[model samples]
Target: MLVDLFDFALPPERIALRPAAPRDTARMLVVTPDALADRIVRDLPSQLRRGDLLVFNDTRVIPAQLEGTRGDARIGATLHKREGPRRWRAFVRNARRLRDGDLIDFGAGVAAAARDRADDGSWALEFAGDEPVELLLERAGRMPLPPYIAGKRATDARDADDYQTMFANEPGAVAAPTAALHFTPDLLAALAAAGVDHATLTLHVGAGTFLPVKADDTADHRMHAEWGRIDAATAERLNTVRAAGGRVIAVGTTSLRLIESAAGDDGVIRPFEGDTAIFITPGYRFRGIDGLMTNFHLPRSTLFMLVSALMGLERMQAAYAHAITRDYRFYSYGDASLLLP
Candidate 1:
């Protein structure tokens, strides 16, 4: 399909610079097959059925954004995928100034050598130290905020908390699962009271998620790989939920994609742990998930295409139009949308 089919205009002022004060107070747009409803994030329990299960991505957002210098040239790096214990694949800003063996020094005694460049222009960076990369990152890196948000304002200390979800435990993701950001302890209690169960999987969301689809056609686009894991216990539980006639609703696209990657054509989910570069577009058959909860996406983005695959392209276009007119927030720190097709 033509990428332009998913294009839409969004007002710059509609972007949210900060989250709702209480988190769960954020607005939600519920999009069903035939209707759209406006509600708040705290009202999720009432919106979902008693037998439904919400799958969350427990991947924690790390402070992966780094600014360093190789000689006189300034280099910026956002570590996306973990290649090894001391190696990571990162997208660099001043990549043109880097050579195969050039070492860039990030202040605070952190430094890494640039390795092989990929077809996407990202390079493998092997840190130079015996210290755990996480510790090194903690000393030298800042939160990897989306370019849309970071372009408007600087990343601050508040983002260390605001960008993470209550379920964050496994630290690796460069990007946060924004849909789960609307969830809180109180909200989870309410959901439990309503008999709605939740489960978790790990999908270390990469900076590639924020990359725009530059290809004119969806067929020409290539999705960057991200690491994810689903244990046998979690897979079994998800299957049990569906077997009991409950709906499996993914809390974010990250969870949904990982679930789909683990599922066979028979629609049974299996334990999986590896890199996934699944690109979901319209006409793809969904096997594992019944619904999705996600934030409003950018124009012509793969995320919008994924949502369009779940709902129809025209339907999502109308839903987005309504969201825009209703003053709903947009992007990684934006309002939520519950899509059921």
Candidate 2:
């Protein structure tokens, strides 16, 4: 499919710079086959069925954005994936100034040597110290906000909490699974009260999620690999959910992609632990998830294409048009959408 088929115009003001004050108060657009309904995130319990299970991504966002200098040239790095305990793959800004073995100092005694540039132009950065890289990032790094938001304003201390979800525990993701950001302890209680169960898996969302589909056709595009894990117990439980006539609704695209990656042609989900570069587009068959809860995505993005694959492309286009006219927020720190095909 031509990438232009997924394109749409979005007003700049529609981008959310901050989250809703209470988080759950953010608007949610419920897109079903028949109609679209406007609701709030707090209304999720009422929207989903009693036997449905919502799968959440437990991967937590780290302070991965770094600004440093190599000689006289200023450089920026956003750690996207963990290659090892002391090594990470990062997208470099001002990368032309970097060499294979040159050391870039990120201040507060944090420095890394760059090497192994990939075809995507990202590099492997090996830290210089014996201390944990997490500790080093805590000292020298700030939240890696999406460029759409960061371009408008600065990343502040508030982002340290706002960007994370209630289910965030396993630390590794550069980007938060924003769909789960609307979930709070109170909301979870309501969901449980409504007999809606929840489970978690880890998919460390990378900065590559924010990268554009530079290819003109969907067939020519390649997705960046992100590490994810689903344990045997969790896999068994998810399969049981579907077998028992319960719906398995993924809370975000990250969860959905990982679930799909773990599922077989027969639609049985299995234990998985590794990198997934699954690129979901229209005409793709969904074997694992019954529904999805995600944010409004960028125009012509792979995410939008994924949602189009879940629901029909034309249906999603209409739904997005409805969302825009309704004044719904967009992107990370934005409103939500519950898509049921």
Give the TM-scores of the predictions, in the order they appear: 0.99, 0.99
**Pairs with backbone N, CA or C atoms under 3 Å apart (clashes), candidate 1:** none
Compute the lDDT of residue 144 as modeled in candidate 1: 95
* Residue 104, model 1, lDDT: 96
Predicted candidate 2 versus true structure: per-residue lDDT over 225-284, tens digit per residue = 999999999999999999999899999999999999999999999999999999999889
| Poorest stretch of ten by lDDT in candidate 2 | 43-52
lDDT of 1 at 221: 97
Q: Where does the lowest 10-residue lDDT sum fall in candidate 1?
A: 14-23
Each prediction's RMSD over C-alphas, in Å, is: 0.6, 0.6
lDDT by residue (1-341, candidate 1, tens digit) is 99989999999999999998799999999999899999999989999999899999999999999999999999999999999999999999989999999999999999999999998999999999899999999999999999999999999989999999999999999999999999999999999999999999999999999988989999999999999999999999999999999999999999999999999999999999999999999999999999999999999999999999999999999999999999999988899999989
lDDT of candidate 1 at residue 306, scale 0 to 100: 98
What are the Cα lDDT values of the candidates?
Answer: 0.96, 0.96
The Cα error of candidate 2 at residue 74, in Å, is 0.4
